[model samples]
Target: MDIQYVDTYELTRAGQEVHGQAPIDQFERLIEDLPEQADTMVSWTVKGEMDSFGQRFLRVHVKAAPMLECQRCMKPFEWPVDSHNRLEVVNSEAALNVDDAADADPDDAIIERILGSQRLDVLALVEDEIILSLPYVPKHDVCTLLSEPLEEEPDGDLARPSPFAVLGQLKKD
Candidate 1:
């Protein structure tokens, strides 16, 4: 689908929906945030409608794998993202202020301040949701062995003892 920008008013008013699967390269911001190069695809489904509160909303579900640097190993790891997000379309500055007041933490729900245009950036929305779905610190459950251990080698070299071990030896003496 050619999801450059969508007409929000018409989409919400008519209660329309859009769905597609696209490569992760399509998401520029998401790619920039990753530490290593990624090769993955993101699938999304966006539905536009007015809720019972008479508020325009876009419900979205996105699935993808983002490449992230492991905190422990500093190696690139792929993290699968499958998340759902809801955004309330706020039409004006006044509407946005009211919505902002209603929820101090915008993360309570995403608010889209339409800033003089009915055009909604579908790519950004999908990107933001995927970013939010990711962990603050991405790491592998078990890292691969990438280097030699801290223990002394079998060639008769003495290993550096721990500070606590030296202190204990002093106490024994």
Candidate 2:
């Protein structure tokens, strides 16, 4: 879903209304399709306002379900993702670049881009949040039903060596 600058401006003036589900395919950059899992559904509401810098700012609250694979068991899992993001729309590229350089935190990179753009792409923002929030390695806890049971060693005793241990002693003679 391409968000146009004009649409954002209109939203700021007349209060934008957001609802319904957004297809995971809309965020092709952030995620790829897998054979085992289904697409994600994102639902959100975005409220826009003018910030102190006279830039348009939007606050988005999103809820989604992302399908992922469990790193340990290689099983598929559906995880719930909910997050809130704040975005600022700037009027010029130079100001956006300046804001990015001044912002020290790596987490704020998306915000900087939004601030630089004349248009606010809410779908892109949601995609960024989803990718950032995903775990590097997904695993189920020990208590989970999917967890594998540990194997026990036989006889509960350590094995001993043979009597031929003395054969090395005779070799020197």
Candidate 3:
């Protein structure tokens, strides 16, 4: 299915929500980070909300399980992704400066800011969030490769001498 775009201002004012499931392959940037493009479906929901102060914002939620290569084992494994973010729609680019905005208003410190857009791409936003949620180095708690026993050599030599054995001999010298 094609990704949808929405008018940030109108959606927030009307308190509307857009939701859909798109295949993982649809997200180009996300595909580059994955081990392989599997038939994974990413479910996403973008809900517009207005605070009591009349400020417009968007609540983005995404969920998916994509295959990632384990850094430790170099093997492919499924990584669960469930993330939510609140983005305050700002009228100008200056307001997008989180540090400045947070300094001016303490409330802005907690919530992220985004430039208001008439054609806000929901798929891009979802992909960005998923990427941000990913670990810098993806790895399993206990890699199967580590737990499994090493195979014996063709000559039936199962044990290899430790590299540290040379250090032990030097100690005697």
Candidate 4:
């Protein structure tokens, strides 16, 4: 299947919007992170606009629930991914680097910069967003390991005596 490509600059200049739904398998890089090939689909919408400063920008939104392995329990769980990004289209990479350096606080900077391209890979962009949205250590709020019933220990000699038992014996003596 052919991956989707868009002319980012033109899309922003024309104020166009495109939306699509694609199977998770289509994202090659994202597939590597998944535990299995889930029957999941990712839905995305890209809207282009010119900001108040006449700067071209693309607003990308993506939503998907992919099965990811939990780091703590080592079990597969559905990870909900919803990401929204505003990409400022820069004429050159130099401009992007300059802006990045000038932004003192990344937390305060809401808009991200990307080099404007005539044929920007849309799937790649979506895949990048999905990966960014994922947690560094994917884990459930409550790991399943804690809920699983532990095997019952055998009683009698197999069970080790408690440390305080010696103190109890001394007290009795």
Best candidate, TM-score-wise? 3
- Summarize candidate 4's per-residue lDDT along 87-165 as a digit string, tens digits: 8889987888675546556663756788899899898899999998988898986785776665565676467645345
> Model 1 residue 37 lDDT?
55
Model 1 over residues 1-173: C-alpha lDDT tens digits?
56757778877888999876667887888878677656556777788879787778777888777788888888887776768777777778787656455655656644554432467777787888888888888777566655444555576445665434533432331
The C-alpha lDDT values of all candidates are 0.71, 0.59, 0.79, 0.79
lDDT of 3 by residue, 32-88 (tens): 857886566788889999989988899999887778899988988777777989988
Which has the better TM-score: candidate 3, or candidate 4?
A: 3
In order of lDDT, best first, we have: 3, 4, 1, 2
**Tens-digit per-residue lDDT, 1-173, candidate 2:** 33423356766555565544566656676567422445445666677677555667667776666666777666676665667777666666666667454655676665633543345566776777777777777664442455457556476433643223322222222
TM-score of each: 0.70, 0.60, 0.78, 0.77
lDDT of 2 at 139: 61
| Global lDDT of model 1 | 0.71
TM-score of 3: 0.78
Clashes of each: 0, 1, 0, 0
